[model samples]
Target chain A: MSALFGRSRSVLSRLVGALVVVLGVVTLTFFLARVVSPDPTNLYVSPQADQATRDQVRAMMGLDKPVLEQYVTYLGQLVRGDLGTSFSTGQPVRDDLLSRLPATLELATYSLIIGTLVGVVVGIVGAVRRGGILDHTGRFVTVAGLALPQFFVGLMLLWIFFVVLGIAPGPVGRLPVGLVDPPQTTGFVVIDALLSGQWAVAGAALQQLALPLITLAFAIFAPIARTVRTAMLEALDADYVRTATAMGLPQRTIHYRYALKNVLLPVLTMLAGVIGFAFSGAVLVEGVFAWPGIGQYALDAIQQSDFAAIQGFVLYAAVLYVVVYLLLDLLYARVDPRVRL
Target chain B: MSVALAEGNLLDVVDYRGGFRGPDGEVTEVLAGVSFGLRRSTLTAVVGETGSGKSLTALSVLGVQPRGFVRTGGRMLFDGEDLFAGGPRSFERVRGNRISLVFQDARAALNPVFTVGHQLIDVCRAHRRLGRKEAEQVVLDMLERVRIPDPLRRMRQYPHEFSGGMAQRVMLAMALVSEPELLVLDEPTTGLDVTIQADIMDLLVELISSSGLTACLITHDLGVVAQTCQDVVVMRSGTVREIATCEELFTAPRDEYTRDLLAASRLVEAR
Candidate 1:
């Protein structure tokens, strides 16, 4: 019964923490938008426009209302899933944000899969061959990866592959601009294309996504690999590993089964951090390639001083971060028995 | 002790030399020309101080020397087969199936994340071809054989749930699961209380005599060696100073190191 109560308390704490984060993000976003220099209404109005025209623009954009009134109205609309209209494009903020979310999610998913696979394999090789040539090579690669910035790497890749080599086509959007009729079951073009048996479109989308995914993956790989290598080394020296070897279990079995299982806690913790890092990398890579992800959209909104679009984007990213971390915590608990909740 | 040796010789180690390389690449021997043998169904205790190469000798039998430390010269025969000559693959076949080791620290020896039953099942499945259900039944049977209370309930408990004695029992069960011909007890009861130590020693003796399993009990306790082992090998630094029957070694010490070790053991018992 005491254990049950402890579990309940943990669950309650998590829910309350999540609520606080959401509230804090919404409040800060509201204030930050209001405090920016040069009113947002001026972005949409001409410099020589009449005072009446400017007043009409302010009223339409809901900027003429009192601050508290605007917040209450925004909160009420948000509760009903209405994110408000964009000040410049006049499109529903929710629709615009949703449309670009899939692309970013796809990019993040691919980069995470690739980065984790490469990082863990390299880490294992490096640890097993400590002080050997493989260890030295892995260390060199990870260090090089850590040194290069994501934007710079992305530009270099574009220059090498698209400009100099001319093997792959130049970067445009997620899909070829000429392919208008994207299969629309899911907003993720790759998944939708595969589901609808449009292998060509899916193949093309994957090809276009590969360079950016590699760039993002490289940006996050060094840290994950370093963490995994450290964890693996620690596990290799653990008593259980020696016991396993003494049992005459195959070296590979001892490594993959026993050593890996014991060290997964550290790797999982590093993996959780890598998810956030990947998201940050996606933002820069997205802007570099003009991939039509939420990152690029947010950047455009900032430049245009579109308060509603900026607020919606920031809120969306915050919610995403919170959900991802919550899931990661639950995963951590499941993988390690020591973690109670 | 002579009668126990008359049964059959199970293990023989002759002139074994092993050492690690220092940072400056100088070879520092941990075990130098150590030699001993065990009868088929008797327990032989290799008594030594800490860093006396007792554990290293046991590891040499299994070909599990530390990395960067080469076994320079050794002839280890197990059941009439040269162990040192056999490579890792052949060593693997003999390790868990024909011989097993129970480490000193049972808590660290067991994987903390897995349940006791799971660890037992893993041992069973590794050396034997058995389905999961069959392996689980074997695990429960072994648990019961080890005298764990409520075998089914204890099987579900993780390593942390067991006391020092119980965890050592689980380790014993794991080592004997495959019915290995030889068992290496590396300071198995060193960390346990006196009462628990007695219980573990009795369990080990009973298991060895009943199953005819040869055991090399590495320990610092002369009393434990006297109680459990038939033959005794006293070591100091990296060399074996004396080897004799348990009675002969205790009744008449030949070397100063052996005498000092016996004196220390007596002090421990007086405490």
Candidate 2:
């Protein structure tokens, strides 16, 4: 009974706690966006504009008021789902985010799925064959993979696949610049193309996505795979494993049913955190591949000092992290009933 | 003990030697020329201090010394057949079917995520030709045989929900669910308090003796040896220092180390 109530209570507390966190992130980013050089008015007005035009533009955005007043107004606007307008694109921030978000979401989701599967399988093999050549080589590869920066890896992949081999599609964007995209029903070309039976468009989009997805997977896979290996190694050394082995239970039973069950909580926690890091890596990867995902959009916004766009990006990222964490905590409770208490 | 030794021995480990090699290839001996035998349907205790490799001696009988530990030379004859003579498949047949092992920490031996009942059912069905429902029934019956109350409710509860005594009872039930001929208990009551330990030991002795099951009890507690075992094997530094009837060992210990152990045991009991 407590486990049932405890599950709901835990989720409620986590969600409520995330509200405070989100508020903090909003307030901090809001103030920081104002304080940072490259004023919002500078982006708005022409260099040759008079002071009157500059003051008028500032007043129009409610930027002439006190910092605290501006913050309050921003919060009020946020409650109404208004992230203000992008200085560069002159579009509502929320709509822009909603449109761009699916691309980053699709990329990160696929990469995480691929990364987690590859990591867990290799991690298990490495751990079960501990101290062997496979384990040693896996350790070396994971260490090198983790140590290398995501941008450098993305650039290398792009260079090899595009410049050296000429097998990959050009890094211009998701689809060929002149080719008509399938439809904007999903905002994601792959999904929209598949839904409309536009196989050619889907194939081309995937071809463009292939390298970035691989790069993102590699970026996330190192941490997740290493964690699985280390956790599995420790779990195999646990007393229960020895007991199972002594019971003459088959190796698969001991490895999968017993050791894997125990190792999954830590692995899940690490896995949940990796998606955030992977999405962040998407920013650089998107730039290298010229993929117009939220990451690239956010980068362009940052470069242009598009305050509203930056706020939405930061807020979107924070919410994603909180949701992932909450989902993982629920998974933890599901796996180990003790967590419910 | 002598009667069964003169007859067909249940298990005979002759001149067993084993050691582990480090990554640097340095060999450190854990068990050196240890030999003992288990009489069919009799309970025996292997008593030793820490680092004595008494537990290793028991493991070697099952052909499962820890990894990286090589068998220097040995023969483990179980039921007239050499266990090491055949491959792991041979041991696999014996394990959980012919011989079962219960460890020191019962809670630690059970997987944390699984209910005691769930694990017991798996252990029951692993070796036996039983469906899930039949296996569950066998587990419930075994839990009762170990004298655990509320077998139905307890089955649905995780290891953390069990008391130390309850957990050991569950361990015993799991070990005995498959009806193995030989039970190897590795300090089965080491983590429990004195009262719970005594209760667990009492339950174990009652179960093993009534069923006429042969068992090897590996423990540092002389009290366990004094109360539960019919025969005793005193181990020191990886070798069997003495093997005798429980009466003979307590009454007339020959080795100086055995005498010292007895003195220490008596002092602990006095405290």
Candidate 3:
């Protein structure tokens, strides 16, 4: 009974911690949005407007109220899932942000999948070979990836593949402008294309997505490879590895079955970090490709000083980061016996 | 009398030389011209202080030496087959099927994620073609053969769940599952308590005899050699200092190193 109670207490503690973080982020973001240099009401009003027009615009935007009162109103609206109207688009900020989020999620997911597979395989091979030529070559590639910044890589890829080679699809958008209809299931163009059985549309979407994904993946690949290689090397030296070898198990079996299982936690932790980094890094890649993702939206918001849009974007990214990290922690606890719940 | 005199040769080592690379990539010799041979169906103990190349010699025979260490010269023959002639692939076929090694620490030796039964089954599956049920039965039988109380319960338990002695027994079971011609015990009883050490040694001795398997037991304890091994090889500073029958070495030693080791054992026994 006491053990059960102890478990319940830990669960409660985790919930409380998550709640405090969310509350703090929301409050800080609300205050920061209110304190920006330009008055938000002026962004919507004409310069030659009369005094009555100016006062009406200020009152309409709630800019006439004190900062604390405005903050309280924002918090109450946020609790109700109302992100308010955007001054620039005259659309609901929540709808605009939500609509853009899925595209970024799709891009991030694809980039993560490609990065993890490529990184883990190379890392394992490098570690297994240690000082051999394969190990040396893998290290060189990883170092190159680590040193090259994301935007530079993206620009170079565009120049080489799209301009010089002229083999890849042109950098217009995620899918061909009007040639294909979006799929209904997930609204992610790639998934929708695949689900609709339109191989050409799927192929075109993939081709369009390939350059940005590679750019994002290159930024993540180096760190993931380094982490996995270190973890694999440590696992290779473990006693169980020696024991497995002593048992006459094949080298591949020993490496994949015994060593890989133990090192998965470290690799997964690195993967979680990469996922978070990729979300932020996607901003540059998306802008370079002209992909309509939340990252590009965020960039536009920064340029226009769209305070509500910026706050919503930041909040969305924070929630994404927190959710992914939480899921990873749960996964790690399941895979490793040493981790307490 | 030496068991070497009683039975024909099972394992022979001659002129072994192995070492790791220094920081500057120069060869730093760990084993220098060490040589010994063991008779069939008997335990031969290699006694040495720490870093005396005892474990290195055993690893060389198994063809699983540490990285960066080169075996510059050696001929290790088991049942008249040269171990060094074959590459890693060929060595894999002979290792664990013809010869198996038990590491010094059993707790670290066994895979923590797997049950003892699973490890045993894996050994069987690696060397032979057996169905899952048959393999499991073999594991249970191995557990019983090692004198583990309640073999069923013990087989299901992981390495960490077992006591030190029990873990050692599981390791022995793993090593002997294929009934290899030779078993290398690298300080098998070093980390156990006094009482547990005695029990494990007795268990090993009984298993070796009943299975008619040869053993090369490596330890620094002369007393353990006197009790369990028929022949003894004394090593110091990466060189073999003496080799003799257990009784003869204990009673009439030649080298001062052997004599010093016996004297140390006597001091411990007296205490």
Candidate 4:
């Protein structure tokens, strides 16, 4: 019972910590947006517009009030789940994020899954065949993959597959421009299409996703494979691995079950950091692919000086990172029993 | 050792040579033609200094030597079968089936991720082809034999949860659960408290006598040798300097090095 209470208390503390981080991001972004610009109203209002129009816009945005008052008001609205309105689209920022978040998440999630699978397999193979040809080749490829810039890789892949070879789809949006979207249940085009039994639309969605997915997955998997290889090498030399081998366990069992289990926690912790990098990299990937995700939304907001939208995006990302790290900690406790005690 | 006398031995390591390979492929030999024999149902101690290659010799027999170690020329014969000639397959058949090894730093030797029971069950299942239930029973029985309190609950705990002495007991339980014909203990009491060391040594002696298991102990502790082992192989600088019955070595002291080792240990004991 005490253990149960302790666990719940820890979870509560983590949740509180996550909220604090989100709040800090919100406050910082708010002031930075306010301080960096000349005036938000000038970006919205034309020079041709009269002084009356500018004054009305400023009052409507609560800019006429004190900064502290505006902050308190913003905080109050955030508590009710409102992110104010975007100046460019004139839509609530929350609604805009809700529409686009699924695309970003779908792209990031698929990339992470693919990256982790390929990386782990390549890592284990390299470790097992250490100093052999395959090991050397794997190390070279992963190092190259990590060294190349993500945007350049995306452009190069596009040049080869789309522009020159004409094998892949063009750098269009998530689907063909004229294709009507499936009902926005979860907002993810592929998943919603699949749910609504729209196989062709889902297939088209995946086809459009191919290059960006490859670009992002390559960027993510390179670091993962390198880290896993190093960790596996160390784990393979651990005394426990020797003990397992001495027990006459099969070679495969010793390598995978004993040595691999020891490296999982470290790999998982690295993945949390990788996911954060992926989220930030999504902005460039989304721009390259012209995918209708929050990365594009964020880019447009920044160009248009939509302060509310920018603030919301930063806050959303902060919350996401905190949640991802929290989940990984729980997983660590599961994988390494020492963590539980 | 004469061939006629070695005929009754369970393991006859003849002129075994092994060493670590350099990065440029040169071999720096550490165990140069070290030979020994283990008679059935007798406890033999290989006493040596820190750099004397005793632990490497034990690891060589199991075919689990650390990476980069090259076997230049050797023959490790178990029950008259040349293990080196038969390759890894032969070592696989012998390890944890006919022979088991226990090392120092038991906590580091047990995988921290696995429950103690899980590790023991794997050892039991590997050699005997037992079902899950039978394997669990075997593990519990061995844990009980090792005098671990509350075998059922304790088995579910991880290695880090156990004290150092408890971990050693668990390691012993793991080795013994297979019912191997030979047990090689490599400084199994080092790093443990002196009192805990005594307890583990006593348990080892009891287990060896009760099961009639032929055993080899590798340690630098002469006191442990005098108390538990019946025969002694004194090693220095990658070679055996002396081999005698424990009584003969303690009473007559054939080699200068053996006599010096005894004197040093005795001085420590007296102090």
**TM-scores of all candidate predictions against the true structure:** 0.89, 0.95, 0.90, 0.95
Best by lDDT: 4
List of chain A TM-scores, every candidate: 0.90, 0.94, 0.91, 0.93
Interface RMSD, candidates in the order listed: 1.3, 1.5, 1.4, 0.8
User: What is the full ranking by TM-score, best candidate first?
Assistant: 4, 2, 3, 1
lDDT of 3 at A8: 64
**Ten-residue stretch with the least lDDT total in model 2 chain B:** B1-10
Residue B29, model 3: lDDT of 84
For candidate 4, write residues B137-194 as lDDT tens digits.
Answer: 9899899999999999999999999999999999999899889999999999999999
**What are the Cα lDDT values of the candidates?**
0.83, 0.84, 0.83, 0.89
Candidate 4 residue B23 Cα shift, in angstroms, is 2.4
**Which has the greatest DockQ?**
4
Worst 10 residues of 1 chain B by lDDT: B1-10
Q: Which should have the higher lDDT, number 1 or number 2?
A: 2
DockQ ranking from best candidate downward: 4, 2, 3, 1
lDDT of 4 by residue, A91-186 (tens): 999999988877888888889999888888888889889999989998998998889987789899999999999989998988977788898887
Task: Report how far residue A185 has shifted in candidate 4, in Å.
Answer: 4.1
